[model samples]
Target: MIKHTPKQQELQNLQQHLLTTLHRLCPVSNGAAPPPPGEWPTTRQLAESNDITIYQARNLLLNLAGRGKVLVTPGPVNKSLRWYPSL
Candidate 1:
């Protein structure tokens, strides 16, 4: 089983909340699906939108990507990432 720290749990909660918010805020043709791959927001944008540190945002997304909750892709440059919800 996976044990998460208190802070990690908090972030996980935030990530779920973010998904709900994103689902509402993100423009999608299909009401039930996440945005297209091209429309996936950058990690920086996700952090800025949620007022969280990039480290926190990236780690959360990384965890999700690992678990197949989201689709992650490398950005055009180093130290950058893009993600779209798969949940």
Candidate 2:
């Protein structure tokens, strides 16, 4: 059996909430066709779309990435990191 600390549980809950919010914003399609690869969106874009702070967006993406639910790509020099939902 796996054991999780209190902090881990809290983070898990936050991740779930974030996933739900993300799905509501950008739903996953269910059809014969799969989503295209390399569809990373910047944190700023997500923040603007969801009316959230950039910090919140970045943390959510990082937590999602930690759970293997998204991919994080560091942008070019001095650019903000971009995040993509795993398809």
Best by TM-score: 1
Give the per-residue lDDT digits (tens) of candidate 2, residues 1-87: 899999988767766655665566556676433333334456776777766688877897787888789766755323767655555
lDDT of each: 0.72, 0.65
For 14-87, candidate 1 gives per-residue lDDT tens digits of 88865665555554565566545566777788888888888888888788778887778755334567677665
Task: Please list the residue runs of candidate 2 whose C-alpha ends up more than 4 Å from where it truly belongs after superposition.
Answer: 1-39, 75-78
- Against the true structure, candidate 1 reaches a TM-score of 0.66
Give the TM-scores of the predictions, in the order they appear: 0.66, 0.54
Error of model 2, residue 11, in angstroms = 7.8
RMSD of 1: 3.8
